[model samples]
Target: MARSINQVAVFGLGKVGELVAILLADAGFKVVGLDAVPRTMLTADGVELETRPLDVTDAAAFRDSLRGVDAVVCCLPFHLNVMIAEAAYDAGVHYFDLTEDVPTTNRVMELSAAQPAAGRTRPTFAPQCGLAPGLIGIVGASLAKQFDEIRSIELKVGALPQNPTGLLGYAVNWSAEGVVNEYLNDCEVLRSGRRQMVPAMTEKERVLIGGIELEAALTSGGLGTMCETYEGRVARLDYKTLRYPGHFRQMHFLFEEMRLRDRRDEVGRMLVDAKPPVNDDIVYLHAAVEGIKAGEPFRENFVRAYLPLEIGGRLWRAISWTTAASAVAVVELVADGRLPGAGFVKQEDIALADLLDTHAGRLFGHTTITQSERA
Candidate 1:
């Protein structure tokens, strides 16, 4: 009965981009899916849409495409989000992206700060609107509000294949570079109200859920934008990625002893060579909030069971729906004035309850499960 998002533009019609377009289009929005490699994009399973060939690196061309669009949902890889986000700002379009690049997000934040606030006619900028940083930030922030005094918040998420045919039990569902880069980078963790950097694979733990044995270890970007939002409210906060058993050890060798961390170019090349890619995958999310509740310590958790599903005849992995839809929900919310509607917006700025009621975020509501079931 309510219309918030009308005109939409999705940049980069890759594996995830196609799904994003179909879902938004299904929501009764005018959607345009653009890509640099037009040859790589094909019609999604259930929807019929035209693809605009775009070279985002060309500043003028990129801005020209943004004209008259209310919000731009960036489905491009992490590297391109920076350029695309800048263009969105210059074109006076609200921005939403799936970038987990800390540096890129920081730059966007800086740009948002330096630029003049939006007038009544322009859209604001909201970057890094994916599962981990996007949904986790919103959901975790919601749980925090229920507490009298918060202690810590930990968010862990993984976009993996629902059904696997290989030993990794995984597929190239998302960005391979994003995966390898986070694995190698020094991760940030808050311990006792102080911020510290921890090695990616150093802190390992074994977790079993639904009789499915898996491993979770420290990974950058999984915490999303929670670190800045939770600042002093929480004491210890960190994020990890869930993987099948023994997967950590195998990657430890490839990234550490084998020096793939130092030679990621070679490592990324090997992944392209060895592992086959697929579009069928699952997106896993786990977030826990601990704090004092009525003079008692309590924890509130959110978890979900996501799998690839068919929408409008096209099938896409759970990650595509969860990540893209969550970002789009925020875009819609901001457009409708449910959010602040101007300047920089963070994922946590969204109210989880309101988000779950929206069309795009309702996708998360249907796929969700209890924390114990997903853990």
Candidate 2:
């Protein structure tokens, strides 16, 4: 059995990283928050936290900080995650992150599969532990298991203002780079038992949730490893991002016609400067699976909405809370042996019920499962 994790080193002090440190500390783990820039003392729910100043890009400094730490949770930018992940592997500590970049995740998977040093235990590497790629994949995989002959699996997730007032009908509650990347990259899917890539924002469809009309379209990284996990078993599997009506058309213009997709950095800056983050945000989650169960075709829908939560006496946006909570929950599960301690761990490998039952995951509220008539 793997030794329990008692001390954690969290790299990066961004919004999600801050909350991750706080939540882990609140959960009674010894947490050390690391960042390149100096930061003021942090307190979550009135409990003070221990923070360190260190540069993750510096190999010696990064590996030194991981000394005596059981695990390292990375909240750094998707592009910069590989450095810290490499440091964690060298230090022989378990690693986790909320990255959605395909190339970054692939690199981490490679690191996870590599052989460890002499007599050292191999550590686990779990990535994309946030929102769409995190909880959505967990729920989708769980639902897919209920069927004997899987047909289609659809996933849609969004973080939007409760009362959208912008031209795009959205707010930048999360990383601007992430939004632009998902919007511009090709999405992975399984069509007719074959894995394929489709253009993002091409399959626009209107969906209604709780009486509000929303739009969903193909998006990258949201599917995590589900396409590969269910490739041959499920006939059709795809993931889409939900937005308010007309948002897709506007994005299509900026990315396709205006050629912003070619200039992602400028586009990211524009979004950060324009769509300011909102506190009163809602996270919409929807997962549906269709397959033959007990000789009858069945369809199951798992839907839930998350709002801003008051944690540790602070009001956290729905996106921040949900994303941080998912990462924290996975860390706890790893610490307790509920998950693998070595090698690459995919989001779909986690069971939905196990995730929801965790203390941190309870913020999303209970999942509602509905069954549709036979197709």
Candidate 3:
């Protein structure tokens, strides 16, 4: 039987969490916004959201809050995801999050696997349902299906200010801790049909899209489970974070030379203190798949640039809208029986066409192109 999701609890009141609460409320779900600090009262399309003050670190409080809730959408930091996920599993409610941390996601997977044996009702668990690992992974899988034999699959995504005016050439559009983690961790990729790990910030390359040159480098967690999904199939598969030229060199200097990578807490604080958050930003996405179709070599590229959007009677940054919308859309799919209802779900399992048709996902617009372009 398909479980109907009505009441949803969104843990975390940050930018992305706020939007998630609003979007879900507007979609007619009873939304509860929970955070360590109380959120200012707000409404979406005349729906007043219920706000709760609770510390997610308090396992008892967190589990108690899940009572009577149909689903749990976690927008908390990556490190706190496992705790909330375990609580959600204990409460027997659907779980979703935007975490890009590999180890945290693995923990969620483990919890999802420990559900009661068959014939029992187990809630679904899906992670990394955000920009890079979420939408990009779905698009990459869509393109890969078009090829008779996949050779290489590459994904690049970035959230950058529409107008640059700084030395770093970047603004804090999302979580600074997430940015630091990606910069310092080892990235997973597939080479010659085998899975391998490579250091982040390496393999810097210049890429041109829409007549603009941007730099991309190996980044951690952006590939999500795509490397595992495409293992033993694709000859090469990897994901990189896109940034303006000279950005990688500057990051390399800070993490490698300054030794900030050794002390991530200071690095995160430094980045937050230095780079101010920007609302006028663009979310850039690009995915390319190369393979043989009918014995003829071919390649296809998917590209899009998303700017700030007006939704739920407010303006949201591109990063916030893109990330929040992807998570919400997955929830809708799961609720509507369009996706799996129990156990772990991967972003690649979501179809691009289905995602673009959702109310929240539609905010990304329909500008995606599937052309014979090589990258």
> TM-score for all predictions?
0.90, 0.95, 0.95
lDDT of each: 0.75, 0.86, 0.87
Q: lDDT winner among the candidates?
A: 3
Candidate 1 — which residues are off by over 4 angstroms?
Answer: 1-5, 39-47, 117-122, 163-167, 371-375
For model 2 the local lDDT of residue 178 reads 88
Residue-level lDDT of model 3, residues 1-375, one tens digit each, is 544799999999898998898888766678899998896746655656799999776768878899889899999998899888988887788999999899999999998899554554698999999987899999999999888999999999988887876667899878888999998889999999999999998998998877767899999999899988999999999999999889989988898888777898888888778888988888889999998976899888888887888775788888998899999999888888889988999999899889888777777773332234663
Q: Provide the lowest-lDDT 10-residue window in model 3.
A: 366-375
C-alpha displacement of 217 in model 2, angstroms?
0.4
Write the residue-wise lDDT of candidate 2 on 156-217 in tens digits. 99889999997799888888988999998999999999999999987899988888899999
**Location of the lowest summed lDDT over 10 successive residues in candidate 2:** 366-375
* Candidate 2 to truth, TM: 0.95
Model 2 stretches astray by more than 4 angstroms: 1-3, 40-45, 366-375
lDDT of 1 by residue, 229-300 (tens): 676768988888888777778888787677767887777767766665766666777778888977887887
Against the correct fold, how does model 1 do in TM-score?
Answer: 0.90
lDDT: the better of candidates 1 and 2: 2
Name the lDDT of candidate 2.
0.86
